[model samples]
Target: MQADAYADIPLPIDPSALAALIGGTTAGVGILDTKLRYLYVNPALERLNGIPAAEHLGRTVADVLPEIDAREDMMLAVLSDGMSREITSSGRTPAATGADRRYWHGTYHRLEVAGQVVGVAGIVLEVMASDEEQRRLDRTRHHLSLLDAANTRIGTTLDMDTTCAELVDLVVPGLADFATVEVFPPDVAPTVRPAPPGVFRMRRAALTAVPGLLERFARFGVAGDYIDHQPGSAVPRCLASNQLVVENLTDDEQLGRVAHCPERVAVYRALGMHSAVFLPVSVRSGPIGVLGLVRAGGSPPFTAEDVVVARELAARAAVDLDHARRFTHEHTIALELQRSLLSEPRPPHPHIEVATRYLPADRQVLVGGDWFDVIPLRDGRHLKAMGDVMGHGVEAAVAMSHYRSLLRLLADEDLPPHRILEQLDRMVERSGLDRAATCLLAVVDRSGGMCQVSSAGHLPPVFIEPGAAGARLGDVPAGPPLGTGFGGYRTTEVRCAPGTVLFMYTDGLVERRGEDIDVSVGRLRELTLPADGSLERLLDTVLDRFGPGAEDDIAVMTSRARPAPGGCAKDLV
Candidate 1:
């Protein structure tokens, strides 16, 4: 039989009889003209659309039934091509009949008058399947979209709290009204033994809610708050068994069993919380945390499918957490080792007070081998040294220690700055060490009121005078970096005024990608220093302006020439 054979009746039938025949049926029948304007609708459609038949006539689907989201274009295509199409549409009813939401499976066909396509007709069947299946596929596409978005939303950073915050952000207002996450402290190692049958101490890493619920429950416990899970609570049970636990919070008796305290029970009731789910986050070693979610307001309780999706989200989060945990562990160990290797510089001489600072890259795991030292020599002279090894982490730090020790041995020989660098280069090359470094040496003669500075491919020293507009760059002869075996180094001498500040630093302080080194150097050259501030303040200003974007380690050292007492200079060194 043809799909629209019933519409081929010879003449219009009795309206009362047609209404009686289809009124009791569960299907909705409607007709429209070639322009896709509604012509007739039965009583069933009136109930389905919650609009009177008179209001539907001569109106497009976009008009009276705009909320249905029905594909009227497909129905119009059937009129022109004389083909049929079937689809399912889900939406809320019009405002007239309580505006209930529903889903309908609809079949549309061409309505023909003689041989000409005049209009289209439709038969819509309300999809009243078993309630479980209805909710499961409420819209399979919606569920899939959430899962797809989880990849980008979760695990954006290695930080533990950030990952948890991303997880809760994804589910709230879309999956539930309130979501929270609690995890063992990063210091706690994951173990196979189950938690004892009592309150387990855990850090609440993240807690969030939709605007409707945030103001009410955000005070009980917030992110970074520590709480103990009740004995045999869903969180501990879920962690122990690695299974999801779902509980209804609306039931008083059930709430008493699930909630740890009476105050919690009262809060749930006040919020109209209907249901909650606890999902365990685990890795290869064992369980580490739990993700908790609660639905309130008019939202329905979580279903079995929700459990599956929540578990998938938890699995992704657990992997990120595990990776972060391992990275943090390694970073901590390397930091401790570097600190142990690099001790503070020696005390400064009376004529020249010195200050030094070391800064590691903010975003990197390893601490690079950038170091500085102040060595007091005879005749009130101070030797200021700053250098940067080629690499990062433990090996680079160890190499830096060797370079500092070798320099101390050479300093006792009283060699000039360039001659000392020449010998150090030969020592490193003959030692067959693979690492390389850039170094700067400045010998300050306080009694003579002068400074002799040299550089081994390092940045120049900055000169700041008390009455000058800003700091000025000193002219220092550049030589090949250490370990290059380059013996060509020339020294430069500059007359220093009393109270002149000489600053030296590693390249990491100014070098950046796609920028000229001279431009970076000029920024330091134009900085104005406080006339009477402490050396600590001067160092702070320099680093604050230029240290934020450094991709490698940084070392900075400063020395100020002190005034001679009794207006008499000591015998020139």
Candidate 2:
């Protein structure tokens, strides 16, 4: 009477608990070993599978699953690693008498008992009401475009965490419902919730402190344990056996106690979500916390794809989360090192106020080569420069730092801006660093209201003063970017009016996939003259259209010349 590894696991939760957890009172769930043998069969699983628990006992999944043509690896994985899997058409396979077989998606969780891994627990559901017959085949046709967008989007993200979040956003909604992430330090409880506000920061803090908990969760058979904080007390569940609850709130005391329903009588009240579902967003690795997704109230139910999407997103999210934590740690060190290399802008000479913001390229360990600095010469002249190396990310960042240092040391020397570039070019080229970069440098004087600007393969600075609006400095661009072998440099003198503001940035701001420098230049002209606006606010709103965060990385530096007495000073924020 000895049943194999499939024996001895607990049965499904009682009817009361089940209704409290699942939003709708309809489905069933069960457990089976890698050999496809029934381990623990729930009453719901029996109802959906059309086989009574008494009959399914000790039977293999193949013998009982009439649907899945089981894969051997997926089977072994259940017992060996406690990995979960999905089979979407299980409900339709065994055509029930009269009712016929409705479609159901199945979600599985690897189960562990004793010190040994054993089987898999599963929940089945009818999903995707709009699906056509050719579901799997139809998705294949869109793979190329999906791959292109995925590759480009994923590649562009410099930060690992951003990349993961982007991935989840891209896949969910269409693929599943809400996606939640939880990260925690070793031996600590996860503190996070989707909220009225302030929740994002809490989630971030948990991840930063715990290094690789996210990534490790993706691999099968993570080792650890789970604790259920029940009202009566608490119970510990095996690491491999994730605890899942499905509850329809209509007749549930626990649901009432939790106040699961808020707008019980509202016309726009949520449905299908009247049923509640709770599961750990965690794996056995370290202490990544639980993720709970509550369905909309008065809704039908949580389908198989719903759970599948959550798990897959969780798998991908794990990579992102770990990377974000690690990246944060690393960025702190790099930013600290970089700050010392950059220049401190001189106080506005009673005429100018300047605000500068620098963002490192988003991906890779390589620092970006974008750099900016403001220097006040002994002659009371202001020196400003912004540059972008050919590549983005950490390596570019390191190079940018190096160039900033060299330029800082040269500022005190009696060299012209052109000569500085010539020397820096030789340094970059001969250093054999193989890194190429572009730069725009300018000099301004408060007393003279005169300006000098030079460019080396960089976006020309936008010059805006009262009345004249934005003008491009430097008639002829200086030689090739610093790292380019054959290059030239030129300078132009401009009579800048007092109260003029000069905006300089790396090419990132004006660059789009197919547009040229002229397009951005034309657009900038239109933007600057916008009847009225603060330079900072304008910069914030306009640049963001094609700038960082939602787009590519951007570096900006703005300096304005003061207004002359008796002249109408244009007040701009």
Candidate 3:
């Protein structure tokens, strides 16, 4: 019986060595059958899984540890190839319940019995350094997403106030519990001298707060309110230093020092504010203003990462604000230049009562080249001219100046209405100027009792007679606009009764979008102007009737014929 070779044998095991190896190691060890069910789990594996060994047995990895799916395919491959492989996987897990997500570097080996693959065994070691690294990576990705959104939302228009509002919207309830943007007025001219420190002059351009705390901060300020920064306030200090000022609202002393007023401290406490940061907004020119961000309770205190994010946001907003500022500066300069060039029209002859009006288009529309002038010509005659260049903005305005000057020079030479326009057309063509304009010229002769009128593709002049029902559009032959060199202008002579009035204007006075020109001009003709009134009264009447469409610039010149000093009307027909 002793020699009968394998009567009975117990499973071989070095219990002491196995215990030492398993107890000394911190890695998790597990064995899975071909069905991917957990058959064996060491004590370390049980602890890592947050489940006891007894509970894990006979349970598939997908059933017991679903978060480890990152390595499920690798484990299957090891079973299929009967080989060993190593993988590093990361994710939330049952073992990490109530804890941060974790990463595990795992090595899987095929387990065989009797030359047939039976299962896969894996040893997993936690990689702790990746925890912080993953968090940093996540934050970086989030910041990038925010910046991308900002690109489309910010600086959508060349308007300073709108840009400020956009900046506030992007940060509210996202970067901070509440935020405010302040800036100098849009009209403030840039200067070499820095802004006075103690003056505390700033326009609250935009303000926003989280939904829960809106009412608490509403009393602080609103957009467009003029706010004064108290002396030694965080805003002015941060702007002066061109740095960020972070204040810890949780600390009483720190909050008091930064609060600058008793009211603000009370407000902060009421709102349960825990932290704040004042970031300076600066561009190439200089500091524009400051962006104030505050956080409330339940929100974590502002960290260094928050400061970095705020600084980046401020940088982007500053560039947009600077662009808007420069646009305003240029628009101002262009307006001034146009005004200077278009001073008061020279006094018309005393024989006639003349009145004129010029209205530039609204801000959204570009400034145009609309102009009107009353020139006193030789031989006691008066010249009335109204012209509009065919463009808008500074270039059109500059062209208008040139056109006005040239017309004056030609009129001073005592040329007739058509001749003056002919010379102007030649000069504009020969000068190689690319601009085109429409003009109307009228010469009122009191001694001759007739008025000569000419047009270069301009709107027809209206003649209103005393006791007439409606005004009459003059039948002057329309010619090509100036710069066309089409010198086919012909002046028309009309009866110049003492009580008659001649009204001249640009197209802007009557034109409307999606309407025919004839219809617009017809509307003006249908309005009855007061015949027995002063030139100013008649001009106002005409404007009232057709002044609705001011999208284009408008210029109106009205000249009324007056009897010369207690004499009857002269007839030279």
Candidate 4:
């Protein structure tokens, strides 16, 4: 049978009977001409549209029910194809009924006479409750997706500014048209006490907005700028009350009050921002800052659902910010401690020129335990010591201090370099300092033209002759690292020609990942000394060649015995 075979059959009911049936039923029924102007509307439709039947005639659906999306496109499509279409639409209508917005399910079909299309007919029924439920489900799913994105996007680094930027980027053009994150300055602590009624201060950490509005919004404040909120402003109120503050800026006065400043009010008006939500970014450490969300022209005011999601996002971001805060605090203390403990070594004898350099690892790692010291001894000899404790951070740095103090005390006894290492190792073990360390000690005797060297599992020192083409590595005997409770260290003597330079450094100066230790050390041995033979210039050349790629902390020291008064030159050693 043909799809439209039933249309050829005659119906027992006539036009009057069909009109009475549609008019009497509760569902709305309407008919339109090819121009989509309504020709007939039953009493039910008049009630649904909140307009009388007489008023609806000769008017299009857009004219009578302009507030609702009645899907006129579907009617036109049905007229073109001679098929029926069912659609569900929701919007506000003039219906003074229950809710501000109403939903309806409608089916549209083409009307034909004499095998030519003349008009369209529609049946509509309200499906407000069921449609609302589906909308809620969809909104819930969208919220979950946003939260999942937050988890991956925010807190990727332990940096406060980066995290704040991530948070604002996630919500703009999705949850809001403009967003900002402001935090307390590092020197100030988050306090629960009510702020003074006159002014509230916070540093702007980040901000983001839709394309055209970002520049306009940035005129009010930029990141790292300190912003002050008025007494009754939304931000201060949100912080004081520990709750979200939603403002619909319906008038100039409302915008002024929420903006906290006249300049901001002008910007808000220019940008057409009419709605805002202020949420406190807080954790167990009281309220740290505030997050501001805004929506501009044509955007609906914030709803209760938006508040719930904004609260959750703020909570998650707060946790990450707190972690960053703590990390920053700890890092500052460690850096201070490392610097204080590693102050410039006391000036060695005027004849013995000393130059030193210390560089910490990258920001991701804390300060490490590399240290150097120059100690003046009897008989015109100066002891140059370089050592590295086995770890990074405060613990290793503190252990380095202990080892330096012990070495200085032992140096006062004027013992041989090997015996000093043996006694220092025993003292560290007995004192229960668990961290092991590698150290190289070189005692230069200018008057005798000889230097005694000892090693405790450390790299050999490099020696540069006054005019040599390349540097030579000292052949000091190796011993177990300090604090290992081993006492078999031996001392070696090397000829210290006048104007010869001795370079000592920690392992970080030459260590490279995935490369043999000998190869890494060889790269340093192949370098020529500066033509001027300046100790400072020699150290600079070494650092320039190898310092940029070092992944660990480095401490380097260079000392050269100048030509002694009335002393003749000796052969290179």
**Most accurate candidate by TM-score:** 4
What TM-score does candidate 3 get on C-alpha atoms?
0.62
- Which sections of candidate 1 miss by over 4 Å? 1-124, 127-139, 188-199, 220-222, 225-231, 251-272, 350-352, 430-432, 561-573
Off by over 4 Å in 2: 1-181, 185-287, 293-344, 348-350, 359-367, 430-432, 469-473, 485-487, 527-534, 544-551, 563-573
| Cα error of candidate 1 at position 172, Å | 2.2
Error of 4 at 275 (Å): 4.2
Tens digit per residue, CA lDDT, model 2, 166-278: 54444433332333333343222234333443211113221110122224323211222222132321011211245544455454343543232322323112222344444
Model with the higher TM-score, candidate 1 or 4: 4
Model with the higher lDDT, candidate 2 or 3: 3
- What tens digits encode model 4's per-residue C-alpha lDDT throughout 1-573? 012122433322354766767868889888787878777777788788888776776678889878778788888899899889998877877775656777889988888877877888889988975577898898888888889999999998877888999999998877999999988877533334454557887788999999978877767778877787887888878889988889889788889878866667777787898899999999986887899999998877888888899999999999999988777677667778888999988756766677899887655567888999999989777788999999988899999999999999999999989999999999999999999999999887766767899999999998877677778889898899999997799999987777777888998888999999989888766767777767778778888888888899989988776554676543121
RMSD of each: 10.1, 19.6, 10.3, 7.5
On residues 322-392, what C-alpha lDDT tens digit does candidate 3 reach at each position?
98877767666667777888887856655567688877665446668888888887877878899999988
Count of backbone clashes, every candidate in sequence: 0, 46, 0, 0
Those runs of model 4 whose alpha carbons end farther than 4 Å from true positions after fitting are: 1-48, 51-120, 123-145, 172-178, 187-201, 207-234, 248-275, 294-306, 351-353, 447-450, 464-470, 495-501, 526-551, 561-573
Which ten residues in a row are the worst by lDDT in model 4?
A: 1-10
lDDT of each: 0.78, 0.55, 0.79, 0.83
Which ten residues in a row are the worst by lDDT in model 1? 1-10
Q: lDDT score of model 1?
A: 0.78
